[model samples]
Each structure stands twice: as structure tokens, then as C-alpha cells.
Target: MPPYILPFEKPILDMEKKLEDLRAFSQAQNIDVSFEIERMQNKITEMRREIYENLGAWDKVLVARHPQRPYMLDYLAAMTTDFTELHGDRVHADDRAIIGGFGWLEGRRVMFIGTQKGRDTKSNLERNFGCAYPEGYRKALRLMKLAAKFGAPIVTLIDTPGAYPGIESEERHIAEAIAVNLRDMFRLPVPIVVVVIGEGGSGGALGIGVGDRVLILEYSYYSVISPEGCAAILWKNRSYANRAAEALKLTAPDLLKAGLVDEVLPEPPGGAHADPAAMSATLKAALLRNLEELDATPVEQLLEQRYNKFRAMGVFGEDAAPAPAASPAPAS
Candidate 1:
């Protein structure tokens, strides 16, 4: 299958194609071109570095949305053992977009939950392009409650454009489903770790994003609104999505600096899709380390800190307007 080429990746792809042709020609003619191949390889490395090193927020968005980027199941397979999937909200049908189950991470048994996006057209349709309905949120909460009941820590992977916004979603009360999760997650006794592994869009991501340690992959974005959605609303055109991405400060680094994200996990060079195994390893280590830290705190203290962590995120500042001095004098 052909790779999904983003707009900015065209140059890099062109260089790689030339390098491939050179190698093939050398082999066909039975000639030694190893020196040239090495030189070209070095050039390609620098090319990738230069491009990735200076990526803008919009560029990072493209990378985050890349079709081949590792999803929740990929991370689960890489980081856990003894995986067992649990399904259904018990009140509604099972939602495939948001999947959760029990998995052994490192030396401890933990509950794993995350939004899953599909790899192809068929799967995307099945996953509804990673948009969850009310049942998805309810199912996630059910899983979390189960984890808490078992005295196990909870790990949530977030990646979605937003909650499903179709008519059926409203009919099922999507907002209420997410609101309940947001409220209940804060009160859960077990430690919860949330990772924004990809496009963390609006209430979709937030439905299950609460936790003690909120981490984000370097290229992933977490925002109340997607850039395109914001652009369409604010600029009246989706083409201004790039500008909206910049203004939203949704990138991992941006969110970290703004105190919205606890930490930013650096992706493998050229982004996560370029080296999924490496990215997965980094994610595994981070999850274990954060989980270890949370485990050390008492349950009461953990819940307190978890609530405060999110509370602290809503920091607001309002400049008090100058009193109507002139009007007061006139009244006097």
C-alpha cells in the first residue's frame, strides 16, 4: 500500500524516491554505488531533521492526524500483557470507538481505556472516525468504576476529533454522558493517568481525559475545539484552520507551557508514525513512571490532588474595570 503523504512531506518523499531509484539502478547494473547511497542516506536524515525540528503548530496537526500513527490498541499491545477487553455500558449497546479492558502494565494489573481510530476506510466507518456517542462515554465510566472497585489504577488514552455530533448523539444525550464522566472521574478512588496520544478534540477527548497525570505526545493536540471547527466558526472558513491551530495553542509543547498539560512526551524523530515502536516504548516508560508516583500517594490524597490538578487548570484572570469615578462625583 502507498503511504499517506501529507502536503509538507512531498519534498521528503521525492528525495527518498530518488535515493531508491539510485540503489535499484546500481543493483541492476551490478555496479558498486554504496558511497553514493550512504551520502544520500545522510542527506535524507538531515532533511527530515530540518523539517521536523521546525514544525509549526499546523504542521504538527497534520502529523498527529497522519493515518499510520499508532492508535490505542497499538499502544496496548506494545506496553501491556494479559490483556482482557470489557464491553458495554450495561445501559446501552457497546461502543467500539471507546474501548477499555484489563491489562497488566509492567508488574501491576491496570485497567486500560482509550479512544480508538481505525486504520482504513472500512475501519474508520466502523469507528465513526474516532467520534464517540453517549454510550462510549458511559462504557468508559463503567470501566473506570470497575477498575476502582478492583483497587486498580486506570490509564486512559485520548484521541478523537470530538464526541459524535450526529442527531443520534443528541438524542442519546451526548453532553450529559460526558458531563457525568467528568464528574465521576474526579471522585474515583484509584489513580488515573490520561494521555493525549493524538487529536484530542473538544468534549470527545475531555469525556475521559481527567486524571492525576495528564501527558501528551509531542505532535498530538488537545483543545476544546478542533482547528477546523474553530476556523469555521470564527473565520467562517475552514481554510483558516492553520491560523486557528496557532491561536488555540493546542500542540503538546504549547499546552505544556500554558500549564494545560502536565508533561509532553517527545515523539521519535520525524514524529510517532515514523517510529511507532520507539514511541510506544517512550509511552510505556512514562505510564509506568507516572503510575508509580501516583501509587505512592494515599488514595484520599490522590483524589485530592487529582481534583486540584484539573481545578488548577482552569486558572482565570479578569481585569477589574476602573470604577465610574466621574459618575460617582456627579451623583455626590
Candidate 2:
């Protein structure tokens, strides 16, 4: 199959095609075209670097949603060992969209939870395109609670467009479920690490997003809503998604500047999809480093810091007059 191409990737893709044809001709003719091939390869590398260096927020969104970008399972496979998946919320049916289980990460057993999107039509249908329902959140919370009980650290991978918006999802109380996760996660005694691995959209992402340290991939985006959804609401036209993406301040660099993310893990050139193994290695190292730091802190202090970290989000204006200083205490 032809490699999936994004709108902004046309130039690179065209060059790649030419390179492929050149290689084929060179092989067919038994010709010595090594010099030309090397030159073209260097040019392609330079072009990719130029294109990725100055991407706008909207361009980052496109990279975050790239078809071949590594997802939760890919990271799990690369970073964890002795995996064991746990299913169901017990009170409701199991949700395929959000998966959680036990895994060993760098010699420490941890609970792994993440939104899972599929690669093809049938799989996407089954996974609901990574949009979770109430049960999914509940399942995630269940795993979180289990991690705390076992004194295991938790690692959550976020990648979702949003929670499922169907009437059935509402009826099942999706909002309440996510709210409960947000609340309970704050109180969990074990260290928790959250990573925005792809399109972290709305409550679906937040359901498993709260943690002691929140990391975002270089090309990933995390926002209260998807760009398309924001465009529809603000402009009544989804075509304005590019504008919405810029306005949302959802890119990794933006969030890092705003102090919303603890760290931004760099992706390989051309984005994570271009080199997933390298991306995974970098992510695993970051996770282990942060987890070790958190593990060394007292549980009470960790919880307090986690609470304070989230409380500090959003803009807050200074008190208008600094509340006039208390009148000089009575001398008498």
C-alpha cells in the first residue's frame, strides 16, 4: 500500500517517489548511481528538517493525527514487559476504547492505561475510533484504584478525539465518570505519570490524564476540544479548524510555555511515525526518570504537589488593590 500522506507532506512525498524511481532504474540497469542517490538522500533529509522545524500549531495537529503515528499498544510493546491485560469495570461492560493492565516498566511493576485507536476501518469501528464511553472511564478508574492498592505506580497514555458523544454515552453518564476519575486520581497514593501520545481531546483524554507529571510528545496536541469541534462551535464551519488549532494553544511547546505540561518528549525527524522505535526509546527513558523521582517523594507530599500543580492552571488576575493592608494594629 502507498504510504499515507497528509496535506502538508505533499512535497516530501513527491521527492520520495522520485527517489524510489531512481533506485529502481539504477538497479534495473546495473548502473553505478550511488553518488546521485546519496546526494538525493541528503537533500531529502534537509527538506524534512526544514519542513518540521517551523510547523504551526495546525501542522502539529496534522502530525499528531498521522495515520502511522505510534499509539498506546505500540508504546507498551516497546517499553513494557510481561504484560497482562485486565478487562471490564465490573459494574458495566468492558470498553475496548480504553485499555488497562499490569506491565513491568524498567523493573518496576506499573499499571498501564491508555486510549486505543485502531489502524483500519473495522478496527476503528470496534474501538469507536478511540472515543470512550462511561464504562471506559470507569474501567480506567478501576485500574487506577487497583494500582494504588498494590502500591504500584501508574502510567497513562492519552490519545483520543473526545469521549463518545452518542446519546447512549450520555445516558451512561460519561461526564460523571470522567469527573470521578479526575477526583479520585488526585487522591491516589502511588505515583502517576500521564503522557499525551497523540490527539488529547476533551474529557476523553482528561479521564486518564491527571498525574504527578504530565508529559506530551513533541508533535502531540492536548486541548479541551478538537480543532474541528472548536471550529464548528466558533465559526459554524469545520473548515476553520486551522484557525481553531492556532487559537487553542494545544501544541506541546505552547503547553510547555503555559506550564500545563511537565515535559515535552522530542519525536524523531518527520515526527514519531517516521521513527517509532526511537520515539519509544525516548519516551520510555523520560517515563522511567520521572517515575523514579516521584517514587522517592513521600506520598503526602506527592499528593499535595499534584494538587497544587493542577490548581495553578488557567489565568488568574491579581487582586485589584491587594486588599488594603490591615490597619496598623491598635497601639493600646
Candidate 3:
């Protein structure tokens, strides 16, 4: 697929195109325009910094949804030595939307699971655009149990917009499946680390999201609903998605500040899609570091910590006592 560019990234692309054309022209004419090429390169570098540094919440949403951004399979391939994909909930058909397996993470045996999205129309249809049904959550819970049974740590990558909202999903009791996973994950005996690699939307994300450490990529988001979904409900128009995104507190920095996530994993300067290799390396290091920390803690303490971590979320400030309304404004 061709590179997917966000609207605000146009300036950087424009400069890059100019630089490319200049290099081509100089080479074709056998001219030594080294000074011009170097100048253009420097200018493009500065432009990239300026644009990426000032990205708005909506811009981040765009980045998180970028098709070229690395997916779960991409990261597994880059970070793990060998992977054997496990499928199905065992009671139902295998859900392609949720994939899990055992992998060697730098020689350490670990169970890896994640929401899977596709790159094209046919694949998207097959993956159901990463919207898993009840069976998908069931499969994820099964994998988590298997990991716990073997005393292997679990790592889950999240990037789905949501669970499938079609009638078939309702008929299968999607809510109950996710609710069961949420309850079961807290009691599991192994370390579970969850990462929001991209679109962490609604119950779909939380279905497999409970963990000892919850991390989010710099340009990724974890929201109760998509900005568009929120806009449609709250503002009566999807065009207010940008406003909704700002108000959602879903960005990595916002999530960190709100205590919704434990850490914010910084992505490549222009976004993960700009440099998948670097993003994968950063992700591998962070995962290893967190896993090492979790490994040191006793299993009992680990479970307590995981439970407490999520329990402490959504703490709200109490409203100040309303000054008695000045005794009804002296009705006399």
C-alpha cells in the first residue's frame, strides 16, 4: 500500500518531495548540487520536528488509525525469535480478530495475545476490521488461562476500534463474554502486561486489557468510545469528532496524567508508521523491562498489585459542599 499521510504531515511530505526531485535532477544533469541537497535535508528535518511536536488530539487519532502503522503480527515478527499461533476458543470457531500464541521473547517463554487488524479490503473483511465477537473474547480468556497454567507471563497488544456491534454479536452475548474476562483476569496468577498499540476503543480493549502494567504508545489512544461515536451521541454530528477527541482524555499523555495507564511508550518522532523497526525495538525493550520487574514480585503480590492498579482508576474529586445557597437568597 502507498504511504498514508495525515493532513498535518503535508508540509513534511512537500519538503521531502522537493528534496527527492532535487537529488534526481542533480544526478541526471551530472551537476554537483551537494549544498542544495544538504540544505533541503536540514529543512525537512526541522519541518518534521515542528509538525509532529504540535500535533492535536485529532491528529493523534489519525496517526493511531494509519493503515501503515505496525500491527500485532508485525511487532511479533520483529521482537520474537519464534512464534506458534494458537487459535479458537475451543468451544467455538477460531476468531481471526483475536490471535494468541506462545513465543520466545529474547529466549524467555511468554504467551502473546492481541487484537488483529488487516491491511486491505479482503483481509479486513476476514479480520472483521479487528472487531471481535463474543467468541474472540472467549478465545482471549482461554489463552490467558493457558498462560497462567504454564506460569508464563502474558502480553496483549490492543488496536481495535471496538467489539463487533452487529446483531450476531448481541445474539452471542458479547457483553457477558467481556465481563467474564474482566473478572477472570484479576484472579489470574501470572503477570499480564497490556499495551495500547493503536485504537484502544471501548469494551473491545478492556476485554483483554487488565494487567499488572498498562502501557500506551505515544500516538495511540484508549477511549471509552471512538471520537466519532462520542460526537454523534453528544454533539449530534460526527464532524465534532475533533472536539470530542480533545474532551475524551484518550491520548497517551492524557491517559498517563489521568492514571489510566502506567507508562507512555514513545513512538518514532513522526509516529510509529514512520519507523516500524525503531518502534518495535522500543516496544521490545519496554516489554522486557516491565516483565523483568513483574517477575521479581511474588505471585500473590503481583495479583494484588494488578487488582489494585485497576481499582485505583476512575477516582474522582468530591464536590465541595454548596455554601447553603445563601439561605435561599433571603426570601423575606
Model 2 — TM-score against the truth? 0.95
Residue 207 C-alpha lDDT in model 2: 88
Q: How far is candidate 2 from the true structure (C-alpha RMSD, Å)?
A: 3.3
Task: Tell me which residue pairs clash in candidate 1.
Answer: none
Ranking the candidates on lDDT from highest down gives 2, 3, 1
TM-score of each model, in listed order: 0.94, 0.95, 0.94
Off by over 4 Å in 1: 318-332
Flag clash pairs in model 3: none
TM for candidate 1 is 0.94
Tens-digit lDDT track of model 1 for 64-146: 89999999999999989888999999997899899999999878989999999999889999898999989999999999999
Clashes of 2: 0
Clashing pairs in 2: none
Q: List the candidate 3 regions with Cα displacement exceeding 4 Å.
A: 317-332
Error of 1 at 118 (Å): 1.1
Per-residue error for 168 in candidate 2, Å, reads 1.3
Judged by whole-model lDDT over C-alpha atoms, candidate 1 comes out at 0.92
Q: Model 2: how far is 219 from its true place, Å?
A: 0.7
Q: Residue 283, candidate 2: how far off, in angstroms?
A: 0.8
Tens-digit per-residue lDDT, 1-332, candidate 2:
35788777789999988999999999999998999999999988888888998899999999998879999999999999988999999987999999999999889999999999999999999889999999999999999999999999999999899999999998999999999999999999999999999999988899899999999999999998889989999999999999999999999999999999999999988999999999999999999999999989999999999999999997977867754566566678
